[model samples]
Target chain A: MARPTIADIAERVGVSKGAVSFALNGRPGVAEATRARILQVAKEMNWRPHSAARALGGARADAVGLVIARPASTLGVEPFFAQLLSGLQAGLSRQSVAMHLMIVEDVEAETEVYRDWASAHRVDGFIIVDLKVRDPRIEVLEELGVPSVVLGGPGRHGSLSSVWADDREAMLSVADYLAALGHRRLAHVAGLPEFHHTQRRMRALRDSSRRLGLAETVSTTTDFSDAEGAAATRALLSRARRPTAIVYDSDVMALAGLGVAGEMGVRVPDELSIVAFDDSVLTRIAHPAITALSRDTFAYGRRLAEVMLALIEEPERRRDVKTATPRLVVRESTAPPGAWQGD
Target chain B: MARPTIADIAERVGVSKGAVSFALNGRPGVAEATRARILQVAKEMNWRPHSAARALGGARADAVGLVIARPASTLGVEPFFAQLLSGLQAGLSRQSVAMHLMIVEDVEAETEVYRDWASAHRVDGFIIVDLKVRDPRIEVLEELGVPSVVLGGPGRHGSLSSVWADDREAMLSVADYLAALGHRRLAHVAGLPEFHHTQRRMRALRDSSRRLGLAETVSTTTDFSDAEGAAATRALLSRARRPTAIVYDSDVMALAGLGVAGEMGVRVPDELSIVAFDDSVLTRIAHPAITALSRDTFAYGRRLAEVMLALIEEPERRRDVKTATPRLVVRESTAPPGAWQGD
Candidate 1:
C-alpha cells in the first residue's frame, strides 16, 4: 500500500492541514487531544517521513509566502500584480527562493493561510500587499514569528519593514497638471477605499483640489473593474454640472472611461480630458494614449522582494524603501479645457 | 546553534535547493557523487528533516501544480488568465486542493520545474497550459510518472488527458459572421504561433476564409502585447488595399487596434469593423462595445482544476473535456462594409 500523506492523516483525525502541521511540529497551537489523535492516525498509516524531509531538521524552506485576499475577478484584471510578481520573481530567483502564492477571499481566510504556512515552515518569510487600515493579518503574522515585508506602508505593521511609492505625491502631480491645463471641475475614479494607498491618493487629490480652487471634485469608489469604471464615468458624465477632467486609479479604468466617453459622444482632450494613474500597455494603446502617473512597477516588486530576503536572513535589519515618485507622462488624452470652444 | 537550513547547505556545496532535494530523497536525478556530498554535508550540519516535512511521507500534498511560461509584462495585462485563475481557484477550493503556481521563461526551464516538483512530491499532479506543437514537458512528466491535465487539446500529449475550448469552431464562427457582414479583405492579429490553439485557430480561419471566397486574409503574429497589436494594426491599415474589418486574438490587442484606427482617421464599425476574441470587460466597455467571441473563462479554469484533481485521484481516468463553444457576441463594432457612405 502507498504511504500515507498529510491529507490522509488530517482526514482521519478530522482536523485541518494547519492543525496537523502544528501537532506534528510539536507547535503549541494545537490542542492536546487533537495532537494525540493526529499522531495516532499517522502512526497507524505507517507513514514514515521521507528521508529528504527528515534531513532539513527545522531548517529554512528557502521560500517566501504571499497571500492575496481579493476576488479572483479583481485579481485577474489588475495589472499591478503581474508586474509586481515579475519583479518579485526576478529578485527571489537570485536567491533561488520559491514564492508560495495563495489567493483568499478576505482578511480572516488570509490569516488562516499565514498560520498554515507558518506552522508547516512552508515558507521562511512573507511579502504582504494591499494592506488595510487596521489589517488583522499583521498581528497574526507577528504572532507566528515569521518575517514579512509590506508593500504599501509601514505605519501599522508594528516593526515589519515596508516598501512604498509616494502615491500621494503622484496624485498631487496629476491634480496639479490637470488644473494647470485649465480644467476647473474634475472627477476621480478611485480604487477600493479600504487600502492604505487608495486612501492616501484620495486624500492627496482632495487636498490638491481644494488648494487649486477648483469648482468641484467628485470621487467615486470602484472594485477596480472595467464595468465599474464605465458606470462611474457614465454617472459623472450625466451630472448636471459635469467635470472637464477625470483621473482614474488604474489604466484599465481609464481605458474604460475612454470607451464611455466615446459612446457618449464626448470628444477626448477637447471636451473631457482623461488621466490614468498607472502607465500600462492599455494606457499607451488607448486612442489619445492616456496621460498617466507612470512608475516602474517591476522595480517596485524587485525592491520589495529584496527587502523580504533581507528580513528573512537578518531579522534585526528592518529597513524601509521609498520607491521613486511616479512621473507624469503627458499624452493625447489631456488638453486645455476650452481648447475646442465649439463643444 | 541555529538549526541548519537548506540555504546553508546549498551555499556550502554550490548546488541548487532542487539538487539537494533530489540527493536527499534518494531520487535518481542527482549525480551519485553529488548525492554523496550532499548527504555528508547534511550529516555534518546535524540537520535532520523537520518532523512536519517528514510526516508527509508518500502522501498527497493536497496540491496541484500550474506552470505559466510567458513574459511577465504580457501576462500581467492579459485578462484571460485572471478570469481563468478565479475559476480554477473556485473549483480547487471546493475540493480543498491547493494550486501551486510557477512562472517560467521557456519550455526547457518549465520541464525542470516539473521534475523538481515531482521529485519533491510537492504536488500530486499538474495542469499544463500553452501547449506547443511538440511539447517537451509531456515526455518529462510521463517519465516522472506524474499525472497531468493539459489546458489545450489532448492530441499531441501522448495519452495525457486534456481540457480545451473549441477554438477552431469559434474561429470559423468569427469568419462566417464577418463574411456575412460583407467584409471580404480581412486581417487577423494572432497570439504566439507556438501554441497549439493558436495554430488550430489560424488553420480554421484560413480554411473558412478560403471556403468563403474572400479577396484576401492576412495574419500577423504578436506576443500579445498591446504595442505589438497596434503595430500589426498600423501595418495592416497602411496597406493600399486595407481590409475593412480586423480580428484580434485578445481584447487588449483589439483596444490597441482601436487606438490605431482612431489615429489613422478610421472610424470603427463605419470605416473599419473590429472583432476581438475572448470577450473581456475591455470589449464590453469599449466605445462601440467590440464584437467578440465570448466564453465563460472562469468556468474553463474551474473545469480544468476539477479534471486535474480527478487525474491525480484516479490516474486511470483519462478524460477529455471540451469547453463550451464560444458564442459570437455581435456588438456595435461590426456592421456592413462602408455603412457610413461618406467614408
Candidate 2:
C-alpha cells in the first residue's frame, strides 16, 4: 500500500492541498469544522506529517540535545549523572520537550554530534555538561548559533547561557570545616583534571592549604571511577606521611575509599577521616555515613531546563544563573586527627 | 543573514541543483572532483540539508526512542537503569544513533509519546522497558507498524520483538539458595505489581515456597524507592513471626532494608538475612555487602540496542532474544536463621 500524502487527504476531504496543510499544521486559515473533517480523513487514511516538511515550514522540533563525552562504564555508577538526567527529563518533559541524549568518546566526537544535530534541526537547543577548561566545544556551539546552556560556568562560556553552582566556594567550605577540626594534612581524590569544576575545586583546596599554613595538601585526579578512587586512596594511605583526612569528588568513590580504609584496618573518624564532594542515598546509608557536600542535583537539572527553555523562547535573553552553593553535611566519617602511631 | 540553500551552493559551484543534491547526499552521478568541489562550496556557504527534506526523501532519522514510565526520583538511585542507559548509549552511539529519551508519568503517557514520535518520524524505532501484564502498548505499537524491542518479556508481547532475562528462573535460584541456607520463612520486597517481571517473580517465590514446604512466604509490592523498601522492611520486622530472609527487587531498596534492620538492631545474616534481586557497585561496597541476583546491566543494554538495530534494519525478521539469566551472588547479607530468645 502506498503511504498517504497531504494531496491524498486534500482529495478525500474535497479541500485544496494548502487548506489541508493549514489544518494539519494547526494554522489559522482553515475553518474549525473543515479542519475537524480534514483531520478525521487524515487519521482514517493513516497519514502522518513528514517531519522534514514541518522543519521546512519552520515548526519547532520540540527537543533538546545533551551530548556527554564520558566513559559509559563510569557514567552508569555515578548517581550525580543519573539524578541530573532524571531532573532534566522531569523539567523538560513538563514543557513537552524531549531530550536527545548521546554519549561520545571525546570532545571531537561530541562537537561533531552537536554540528550534526544542529544542521539536521534535530533539537531546538542543547544542554552542555562537564564543562572543560578552555573548552573547545564552546567555540563550536557559539559558531553554530544554536541556543545552548552550559551546565557548568559562571563566566568561561562565550555568549552561551549557563546554570552553575559555585564549585570553588563549596570546596572551600569543606576545607574550612576540616581545618577547623585540626586536620592539618589533607588529600583530595578529584575527578577529571580537565573539567572546569575539578580545577576550581583543586584550586580551592590549594588556596585553603596555603592560607591555613597546613603541612601539606595533595590533590590526585581520577576518571571518577570507584577503582581509580580506591587506587588513589591506597597510594595516599601507603605513604609515610599520610594525610589525616581524605575528600572524594563523588559518593561512589568515597564509599570505595571507605572500603579501602576498612581493608587497610584504618577505622573511619578514629584513624582517618573521609568526605565526599557529592551526596546521594549511598552516602546517607553507608555504615559510617561519609560526610558530603549536599546539593539537590535533581533541582539543579530542573533549573537548567528552565534556563534552556527561556533561552530558546527568546534567544537574546541569555543570562548566567548561579545556584546555591553545596553545603557540607557532616556525618560519622569526619573527626579531629587522633593519636596515630603509624604516622 | 539568511540561511543558504542548495541553489546557492549550485550557483556558486556552477553545477545543476540535481548534481549538488547528489553530491551533498553522498549519492552517485556526480564526478568525484565535481562532488568534492560542490561539497566545498556547500560548506563555505554554510548550507545545511533541511532535515525535513531528507526525511521526505526517506532518509533514516538516526535516532531511537526510549520512553520510561517510572517516577523520576526513584529512577535516579537505581543502578540498574543508569547502567542500562549507559550501555544502551555505548552501543547506539557506535552506530551514530542518538536516543530520544523521555520519562512519562504512566503507560498512557508513554504510549502517547510513541504515537507522536511515530507520526512525526522523530525516531527510527523504540526501546520499551518495564513490560506489564496484558500490555496495551504492544497492540498500539503493532498497529503503528514501528519497529520496537521490549526490554522485559519472554512472552505476552504480541507481534513485537523482545530482549529479556529469565526473571522466573533468576528468582527461583535466589529462593533455592536461601532455602538451602535453612531459611524457611522468606519474604520478598517486589517492585511495581503491574510489571510482568514482578508478577513472574512473585509467582516464582510462591512456587518455591510450595515446592520446599516453607512455613510461610510473603511478597509485598512497592514503587521501588528506598523509602518504600524501608517501610516494607519495617512492617515485616514488626510482625510477631518475622521472616528470617528478605529478598528486595533492587539494590537501592535492599540497602534501605539493610538500614532498617540496623535501626531495629536486627543483625544481618544472624537475625534477618537480606537479598537484593538487582546488583551494582552499591551491593558490593555496603558494610557487610549484599547477596544479590547479579547480571551485567550494561551488557544487557548493549544487547537491547543491537536487537533494536537489527529489527529496524530488517522489520520482517522478528525474533525474541533471551539473554543470560542473572545468577545469585552470595555475600555477607544472607544466612540461616540464628539463635533468638525473643521470638
TM-scores of chain B alone in all candidate structures, in the order given: 0.83, 0.94
Q: Return the top candidate by lDDT.
A: 2
What's the DockQ for every one of the candidates?
Answer: 0.16, 0.69
Per-residue C-alpha lDDT of model 2 across residues B1-343, encoded as one tens digit per residue: 3457888888899989999999988889999999999988888877877777788878789899999888777678789999999999999988989999988988899998887888788889999888999899998899888898998888999889999999999999988988898888899999999999999999999999999988999999998888999999999999988999999999989999998998899998789889998898889878689999999999999999999999989988997999999999989998778866123
| Residue A297 in candidate 1, Cα distance off native in Å | 1.8
- List model 1 lDDT by residue over B228-261, tens digit each: 9999999999987788999899998998898889
Give candidate 2's error at residue A274 in angstroms.
0.9
Top-DockQ structure, candidate number: 2
Clashing pairs in 2: A52-B52
lDDT of 2 at B268: 88
